[model samples]
Each structure stands twice: as C-alpha cells, then as structure tokens.
Target: MNLLINVFLLSVFFPYITVIKSLDTQPTALFLGTVLFLIYFKAEKKQNRYIFYILILSILSIFLFEKSNIMMSIRGILNYWSLGIISYVSYELFKRNKIKNSIIKRSINAWFILGFIQTFYSKYFFKFLIVGMRTSDDRGVTSFATEPTFYGIICIFFGILVIENFKKNDCILFFSNLLIQILFFSKSSMVVLFLLIWISLYILKNISLKAILFSSTSLVSFHFIIINFLKDTRVYKLYIKSSDLKKLFFEDHSLNMRLSHIFYSLKGALQNFLLPNGLTQWIEYVRIETLQKTYFHTLTPTTSARIMSGFGGIIYESGLIGIIFIGIIFFCLKKGLKNKEIAIFIIIISFSAIQPSFPLNGFILGMSIFNLEKRRIHKNEKIKSNDCCRN
Candidate 1:
C-alpha cells in the first residue's frame, strides 16, 4: 500500500493529460480524488480528516456564491482538493518514513532518462504529453513537461528533493539540475531565484563584511557570465526586452499577459472588497478587464490567458481569504523550518514567477513537510540534550 502510494505521489507531475481545454485539467486529479476520498474514511488524524472537511466547505461556498460559473468552480474544487491530497500524502510518506532514500535516487534517475528521451524526440513527446495548450515554437528541451518554463519549475521540485535528501553526495544531482536549467531549458531565472535565496540564507547564517563582499562579487560574476555567454536563453531575451518600456509593454505578449494578471487581479480584488470572485473566474476577470484595451484581441480566451503568477491567482480568486491562507501556510512552514527566512523569501520570490497549478502546489507543501519533520526531530534532540545536562 505504501509502495503504491509512493509511486502515485512521485508521478503526480508526470506530463499531465489534459481533459478540459478551457480549465486545463489533469487526469491525476481524478485518480487522486478517488483514492484519497476512500482513504479519508479510514484516516486517524484530525489533520488528515480536516482536508475533506475543507473540500466540502469549498464546494458549498461555490454552490452558495458562485452563480456566474458553477461548473468552473467545481472544476476548481476537484483540482485544488486533489492537490491538497498530494501534499497530505507527501506529508504522510515523509512523516512515517515511507519514502525510502533509494526511491528518491531512482526518481531522480528516471527524471534524467525522460529528459534525454524528450531532448532527441521533442516534437513527438511534446504532442504526446501536452494537448490543446499554447507552446513556444523555439522552446529548448522540455523533457516530459508541457513547456520549457514549466520544465524549469518541475526541476525546482527535484532540486529541492535532492538537496533535502542527499546533503553529502549530491554533486551529480546538483549539476544535473543546473545543466537542465541552463543548457536544456535555456532559462535560468528559476535557478537564479533559488540561488539568491540560498546565498542570502547562507550570508544571514554567517554574517560578515567579507561574506557579503564575496556573495556580491559572485553574483556580479554570475550575471556577467550569463549576459555574455547565454544570450539565447529565455531570461536573457526577457532582460533584453526590458530596455524599452513601450516595447516591453506592447510587443512582449508574454510579459504583457503576466502584467495584466497582476494589474487586473489587484484591481478586481480592490473593487470586490477583497472577497473571492469565484473559482476559475480569473481568466474571465482578465478578459473583462482587458476587453477595452487595444491589445485585447491579441490575447486568447483559453487557459493560456489564465494567471501565470500563483500569488496573483490566489488574490484574484480569494482576495483577503487568499492572504490569510498564505499567512497560515508560511506560519506553519516557519515553525517547521530551522530558518524561517527561507520560507519568507520563497513566498516573496514566488509572487510573480510560480504558476498556481496541480501537483506543483502539493509537491511544494510535501517538501516543506520534509523540512518540518527534520526540524522537529532536531529540536527534540536539543531539548533532550538540555534535560540530560541539567540532570
């Protein structure tokens, strides 16, 4: 049973099979929802049971208030609940020592193997994995993911898992992730954001003038290397596009779309008194907000036009409730992590970058659980040491 659960947990993000065009549905939701729904009947912990309760409340909220688009709201419920289950299962696996070290090693190996296969046969694999979604014609290696940027995001998950599990013998996995980000994905923003947080934490741990100077120098050198050598990469292109404000706003459809999410989501939330508009209504809100704009015709009404920013989606969907949800999430993360600042930094960086999607959300929470359990054990050991010394 544990092995089966582990397999499902690991494969949650495995090249999602889209079911609905507008909603961007993944089949894993159905599998997860069915399995976890049954398991909830036998759950012992209130923490586990509360998930279903929340799901029920969310469904009720949709029925009660979501008159504009109830079906979309239901889709949202299933998607989020399944994601919540992924997190729950991940927390359970790590907490109970069900996720073996060997499993982690094998999963990382499988990631590389799939990446290799996809690299050589990009067109074939892309069509097989993704359907009815927007994609870049000149995208670099996407592995088993739908797109290059998403592949980078997926790599972030594996990177976190590798760092958490193999502290000593992680050089291969470390560089492999880096290669995937830079050479394969041709996008380094994810890596840069992660490294910045990591370096910031390291400096905070060992605060000194020399440490600050060294980090600053290293960052500058890294930037210089990227600008000079990696001109073809997506981040570099985006950077180049940032020079002209007018061009950046109008010409860069990608940037413009992302900006619209931020601008309109905030505007809509302000007008709605910080209350949730409705589930899956974010794209509609974006549509309504941008319809008057000159560039409205250029934007699609499909899921591709949905909010790319996770934090923005949260605010746009739930408003003040979203803010409270974030607070609770990070508060728990802070309690679990040794360095609460990492949690804070992750939240800040993820504001504009991370997309709010299935399995990704759950995978992150599961990773947080890993750190949380690690911290708890270390804290217990310290308390025990203090008690023994006093005695």
Candidate 2:
C-alpha cells in the first residue's frame, strides 16, 4: 500500500506517461490520491490549521470582492480548493512515511535515461515510451517533457539530487543531465545552471577572489563554446537577437509572452490592492487597450490563460493573501535537504517560470517533508556512531 502511494506520487512528476496523458494528469493525481487516502484511511491527524484558515479567507474574499462574476468566482474557488487538498494529502502521506525519496531518486534517474533514448529514437519509437512526443523540434531533446523549459527545470532539480547523493551512477546521470541541458539550449536551462553555480558558491564557507575568477572564466569559456560549436541551437538565436532589443521583443513569442505576463500581472496586483482577481481571471486584469499599446492585445475573454508563473498567479489572484498562502505552503514543505535554501530557491525559480501545476507543487512539498525525515534519521544514526566511538 505504501509502495502504491509512492508510485502514484511519483507519477505526478512524469506528466508524459500515456495512461496519465489519456486520463489527464492533474485530475488523475488528485483522484488516485483521494482513493488511496480513503483506502489507507489513517485516522492519524496532523495540524494544518494555517492552510484551512487561508482557504477560508480566500473563499470569503471571492464572495466579498468577486461576486460580480459568479461563475468565474466558483471556478477560482474550486481551483484553489483542489490544490489545497492535494498539498494537504501529500503532506500527510510523507509525514506518515508512505512516500520514499529513494523512489523519487530512481524516477529521476529513469527520466535522464529516457532523455538520452528519446534523443535518437524520438521520431522512430519514442511514442512507445512517452505520449505526445514532438517530432518537429530538431533543436534539442526534451525527453518525455512537453517542451525545453520543462525539461530544463527537471534536469536542474534532479541533477542537484544526484549530485548530493553521490551514488555509483551519479557521474553518468549528472553528465547525461548536463548534456541534455546543453542540447535543449533554452533560456531556462542556462539561467538555472548559472543560478545553481552561484548558489553553490555562495553556500560555501568562504568566497575567495580566486573562486570568483575561476567561475567567471568557466562561464565565459562555456558561452564561447556554445556560440562556436552549438551555433545551430536556440542559444545562438538568442545571441543574434540580443543586438536588437526590438527584434528580440517582437520576434520571440516565448520571451514576449513571459515578459507580458510578468509586467501585466505585477501591474494588476498593484492596481487591485494586491488581491487576486480570481482564478483564471487574469484576463479580467489584462486590459485590451493597455495590451494593444504593447501590441500583445491578442487575448480574449474566452481565451484559456494563466499568469504562467507561481508568484504571478498567487499575487494576481490572491494579492496580499498570496503572502500568507505561500508562507503556509512553504512551512508545510519543511526545510528540505541539507541545502534547504537552495532547494527552495530552485522551487521558486521553477514556479516563477512554469505555469502553475497543482500536482507538481504537491509533489514538491511532499518530497521536501520526506527529505526532512530522512535527514533526521541519518543525523540520529551519526549521533549513535559518535557515542559508540566515545565509549
């Protein structure tokens, strides 16, 4: 039963699974979690009063402020409530020892392996392994992910995990991740790489001038190598567009949308007293005339849209409530890993870049708590060994 729950939780991360793809990822995760929760039926209770409080406040906010749009308000409530439930259930499972980090580690390793396989057989037989495999993009390999950005984020996260663990297969998995990131060549990949290095250095006991020089030299060398050898990839395209800000803004749809989301969502949050306009109501905050001034006025009320970021969604939808909301969720997640700060840094980084996925968020929180417990157990063992040595 515990193993079943572990697999179900891990399934949330691998969105490309055919069964999940056919059934839809988020709802399936929620449904399976619900069933497992009912079957296992642990009467053990944990205190998550803060989450419930935020939910109550958010529901009340919708009624008080968003009564004008009854249907959209309901949608907002449902979205928020569903994700809250997922986070709570995940927290409970990990807290109760139903989830395991070892399984997560294996899954991450498998993802990297599949990434290599997909690089060669993407057009031939990749679909046999992953659903919705794209055949057109020759720029890079995305493994089972839907896009380069998602793949990049996954590599950074699991890459960190593998590095920390130092298993016999660590070198192979680490290099495989690095190779895939280079091939993917997306902005998110490069940005995450830079941030990871910076954070790793910052976490060290001392920041010497020599270390800084070496880091700069390595980064410059890497940039030059990419420009000279991987010129056919998207990084070179970004380099060429860097010369003309106008072309960069107008030509790159991905950058344009990202910038637009950040700018408009931030503007909306400030304009609306920092309260979210309601879930999926980001369109309401996006003014057509204002958007037309920037030439991104292509949005419509009926268009399916989100703020395309975690903080963006939180701030745009809940405003000031978002602070309390994220705080509570973060608290539930625990410190996570030895370098808890970096783990959180990566979470925020990914959340801000990717569209909000509740299942993924829940998994992250659950996994963090699991890591905390693992760390405690290891600490206890070390203490016991020390006592034996003293005796």
Candidate 3:
C-alpha cells in the first residue's frame, strides 16, 4: 500500500521526472542508507556484490569522462541502473516471503485506480484549479513528454496490465484499464495494444477465423457507434485521429514523423558509429532546448543512436578497452538468451528503443520476467526429477 501510494504521488505530481529519476536514485539512496544503518547496528552480513559493482562503475565512469556534462549523463544512467537494482531487490524480497503476492496485487490495483482517477481529473476537473490551467495546450495532458509518445508508452503498459489481468479473469480491472487507455487516445498505444492482444491470442492458441471475423465486426461496429454519437466532441476527434485503424495502418502525420525520425536516428547512428557521444551532448550539439522542443522538432535521437552515444562516451573516457568490455558483456548476454536472465535482459534492451532510456520501469520489468523464467526452470527441473524418481 505504501509503495503504491508513493508511485501514485510520483505519477500524478512528478510526471515530469523520467522513470530513472523517480525510481532510481532517491529510493535507492534511502533504501541503502537504512540497510547500511541496520547492518552496522545488528552486525548483519550486508554483502551486495551487485550494488558494489554498480556504485564502482558509476563513480569510475564519472572520473573517466572528466567532462561535467558526460559525468552528469553517467549519473543519470547510474540512477536508472540503481532503480533496476532496487526493483530486483524488491522482487527478491517477495520471492523470499518478505512480501506477499496479495500485497503486490493490491498495490497494482491501487495504482491503476489512482492513475484512472488522476487522468480523469487532468482531463476534466483540473481546469478550474488555476486560472491559466484551462488552455488547450496545458489542460491535463502529459506535461513531461513534448509529444504524445510518452503517454502512448504509458498506455502500452496499462494495456499490458489489462491484458495480463484479463487472462487471469479479472474482467473488471481489465475493462477499467482499457477505458483509461481509450481516453488517452494515443496512436502508438493503440497499435501496441492491438499487437499485444493479437500476440496473446496467438500464444493462447485461441486465434481462429471465427474469432477474427467477430473481432473485426465488433471493432467496426464500435467505430460507427463512436462516430455517430461523439463526432462533434474533442474526445471523439482525438480518438478518430489517434485510432490504430485510422492512423497506424491508414494515414497519420505523427506516425509519418516517427518513421522519419527513425530514419534520421539510424543515419545519426551510422555517422557516429565509431565515436559515439552521450545523448546530452548530442542534444546540445543539436541545440535541442527542451523535451517538448526536441520532440516537436523531431530532434530526439533514436535508440540506436543513444546506445552508440553512450558507448562513444565510454570510449572517449576509457578508450577502446572499455567499449570492448561492454561489448563483451552485451555479446555474452545475447549468447545466453536461452537462459532466462538473458532473455529478460534482451527484452529490457528492446523496450529501451520504445522508451526514452532504460528507466526503473524497464528494470523492474526485466527483473520480473527474469524471475518468471527462473521459476519455470525450477518447476521444470522438479518435474523431471520427480519423473526420474518414479521411473
């Protein structure tokens, strides 16, 4: 409950903070400080090799760069890494019985409920809170993202939660979340939602000609009903413009812009392939003043570019050796994908392309997937052992 409340407050009030900023440094600092204090007082074995390595890498990277901006960027990266550590630790705590699954479920429910209400307030009620708050541009939309992309990502997460819960037969939770996502009217989100649903159906072996026909008919009917009833409203207009059927596969300027941006990012990556710099430096060189400006002007770099930039920064600071080591780590991770941890690591990397950078959310998600894989492995091993004993 406490964790959920904290997340809700952060989401509602500090929406501008990137997930790394919110989940990594602050929470990690507090957690570590308390743990250290406890260790000192109780004479507990406070050994955490991962945390030690993370801290050392972060500090060493800062000194290696010796550039204030690069150091700052490294700090940001460390913050994000810290969040991942925190999430993993939290998951471990749950796995070790320090926390209950029921608690986690309840927390998730609370978060969804809070998110739904806050989004509603932002859409409807917040206008009258302040004199200048009612402007169309400022009226309760994502203040953090310069464009709607971030909201789209959030919608994707929400949609994932909805689908996952729905598969578990939590219909009310699923529908509630779906409604919230619909209200956001994000094109990227709609596309992701469709993809997720389709993939899930395929995975479940529930996809069929009849199912497809029924889904198509239902979607078309829903579209007609929406257009007939809400055509004149702003929400309707936004929905029509952002709908997956209309924008993703049909015609949409925003989608075109994103496609173009992807090209530019790839170009940038190729140009800076050997000597990548940090994203902050690239932004500075590009004279991108703010998040909104960068997004609106299509100046945001691509995921490949960003990773290359980070690699480049390392090279600049620590030379080819550092880059080589990092590359090796990545290579090993790729090679080990059959291992659950590696698969989760890959998903985290893939998700980073869609998100701004690797943040707490990505970290937690990676850890969760990794843990799930571990559990499956354990169960499989147990089953095999049992079968052998019986034989």
Candidate 4:
C-alpha cells in the first residue's frame, strides 16, 4: 500500500502521461485518504498529536476565512491537512518491517526508470505520441505542468537518488539517471544535479579531484548535447527558450514584479495580521490583481509566484499570524536537518519554494523530518544504553 502511494505521488509529476493533466492529485489522494480512514478506525491508538494539530489548523483556517467559496475553502483545508496525513502515514510505514533499505532502493530505481522514459519521450518521441500538445512557456511538456521547472524538480529528486546510489557503488543506476537528466535539459535539474553531487561527496567526506572533474565533465557534456545538438528540435525549442531563461534569472522586470507582489502581500499581511480575507477573496484581490497588472495576459492568477509571493498569499488569506505559524514549521524543519533525514527534508522544502502544490511538498517535508528525528533518537538511545558494555 505504501509503495503504491509513493509510486502514484511520483507519477503525478511524470511528463508523458496525458491523464495526469486532469487528475494529477486524485490517485494519490484516494490512496492516502483510504489509508487515513483505515488508520483512524482500526488502530489501537489514535494518530500522533501533530496530525491533530494539522487538522485543527485546516479547520480553523477555513472558519477564520469564512467568506471563501466552498471550493476555495475545501482546497485550502485539504492543502494543509493533506501534509499532516501524508507525514503521519509515511512515518507509520517507515516504522514497519516492510520498508527495509532494499524496498527503498527498489522504489528509487522505479522512479528513475520512469523518469528516464519520460525524458526520452519529451526529448524525442513526444510529438509522435501526442499530437497537438503544446509545450508550456518554461519548456515543460504539455501533458503535465506548463513550466519545465516542475518536471525539472522531479528530475532533481530522481537525480539525488541516483547520486546516493552511485556513492554506494551502484554505477549503472547513477549513469542511467545522469543520461536522463541530460536529456531533459532542464536548468533547475542541472542546478540540482550539481548540488546533489556536491552534497553526496561532502556528506561522504570523499571530495576528491576525480569527483570534481567528473561533475564538471558531466555538466559540460550535457550543455553540448542540449545546446549544440538538440537546438533545432521542436521540444527543444519549446522547452528550452533562451528568452525565458534570461528573464527568469537576469531580467530586472521579473525581479521587480516579484518584489512588488511580495511587498503588497506583506502590506496586506500587516494590516490583517491576525485574521485575513477568505481564500476566494484573497485569490481575487492578491493573485488576480497582481498578475493582471504585472504578468499581464500571459500569466494565470492561480499559478504560483515567487517565494515571497506565496508568503504574501498566505498572509492575504490567513494573515500575518498564519504566515508566522507556517514559517515556524519551516524553521523547525530546517533545524532538524542536522539529523540524517536532511536529504529528504531539504528536497521537500526546496520543492515547496519552487512549486505551489502545497501539502505534497509539506507532507514530504514533515515525513522526512519525523523519520530523521526517529533515527536520531534511536541511535542516541542505543549509545546511551550500551555505553558501559561496549568495551
């Protein structure tokens, strides 16, 4: 059951599946919801306190912003509550005997293989397979997110798995993932690629000249393939626009718009810092108005903005207090990264900044933190309980 849920969640971001467009969250949600219900009814003890707190926060946020439409309120509530449920369920699974290291290895392998296939299609076969599909502005395949950055994030996740496996001497798996990352030509994935390699070497305390040389070579080789060889390809054109790249990173206008959105949200946050507008009103007032002016007709109101913009959205809907609450959660998780679970937690938090999918990222973050803490506690107990006998 846990494996199924993980696969479903992983597939939610896969780029080649058309069905994902209409029902991206449904499969995972159904599986998760079922598990949640089963746990609630059958467990000898209730779920943890954090789960209860998350539920309360969701419910309270809804009531506090009662003016929101039913759909908005429901989405808002689910967005928060889903995180708690996912975290709790993942922790439960990790605690069980079924989730051994081998299981995790298999799961990671499956995700990498799937990702590789998707990247191949996006790079070469997407047009033949799905006609009339258009790539989004950020060069993502039309079947999933409009932006390539979304897929890039997924590729990065798989890439991390690859790096970890490679460090453990799983050469074939690492190279396979490396090939897929190159095929995708996603800038975000490239960034993550380097970051993961650096982290892996650093964590293992084995940073050597060979590792640095390999990293640099891989990056250069990827650039040559994408830029020099794939330049004339249709998907390449759609998914790798030079203009979007320039604007996303170097342009002043883009930065200004994000800054303006953040400032406005912060202003609203301060005014209604305790209890703010309902979800619908918040969306209309902040997202719609802000995008209409700054993004013009090119951008959708519901699309995620920069980090500060998301922070602003929270403030607009739930006020400064709510933002602070969420901020506290993030801060705690960051501190907890000193534990071994840092890899997963960092992955989740990083995605949260880049994607507006909410509870998916939040849930992953929470689970990673919980699992890491559990590992740390267990290790400490073992050391303390066995110190005198260890001679």
Stretches of candidate 4 off by over 4 Å are 1-24, 37-59, 64-68, 100-147, 160-167, 175-179, 182-226, 229-271, 287-312, 328-332, 335-363, 383-391
Residue-level lDDT of model 2, residues 11-47, one tens digit each, is 6667555564643233556666666655543564544
Best-to-worst lDDT order: 1, 2, 4, 3
Order the candidates by TM-score, highest first — what do you get?
Answer: 1, 2, 4, 3
Model 3 regions more than 4 Å off? 1-75, 79-83, 97-152, 162-167, 184-207, 210-218, 225-261, 284-360, 363-373, 376-380, 383-391
Please give each candidate's TM-score: 0.78, 0.73, 0.54, 0.64
Each candidate: what lDDT? 0.59, 0.58, 0.41, 0.48
Clashes of each: 0, 5, 1, 1
The better candidate by lDDT, 2 or 3, is 2
- Using TM-score as the yardstick, the better of models 1 and 4 is 1
Predicted candidate 1 versus true structure: per-residue lDDT over 1-391, tens digit per residue: 7556765665565635455443443656446635754674467455533334333433444432465666666655554455456666666666666666676666556556666666565534645445643445455555555556666656666655565456565746564665555444435444554666667876887699998997898678667866886576666676576678677678767666666566666777788999887666666665665557555334445744456666666676777877765665676556655455556755765666464445656655655766665776799999999999999
- Cα miss at 334, model 4 (Å)? 3.7
Candidate 4: the clashing residue pairs are: 139-239
Model 3: pairs clashing at backbone N, Cα or C within 3 Å = 276-312
Best by lDDT: 1
Q: Report the CA-based lDDT of candidate 1 relative to the real structure.
A: 0.59
Give lDDT for model 2.
0.58
lDDT of 4 by residue, 1-391 (tens): 6666555444333333443344333335434544654664367375544444544564466565354366556666555555545545544554453333454355445544544554555433344432333443344232233334444555444444344323556646554654454355443433344354545544455357876676677657756765775555433453354458555434434344445556566565666645676566554555645644543333334543223344455566677656655655565454444433444344333423332333335444445455556767788999988996886
- Give me the candidate number with maximum TM-score: 1
Clashing pairs in 1: none
Kindly report which residue stretches of model 1 are placed more than 4 angstroms away from their true locations once superposed.
13-25, 33-37, 45-67, 117-126, 129-137, 186-233, 243-246, 280-284, 291-305, 338-341, 353-356, 370-391
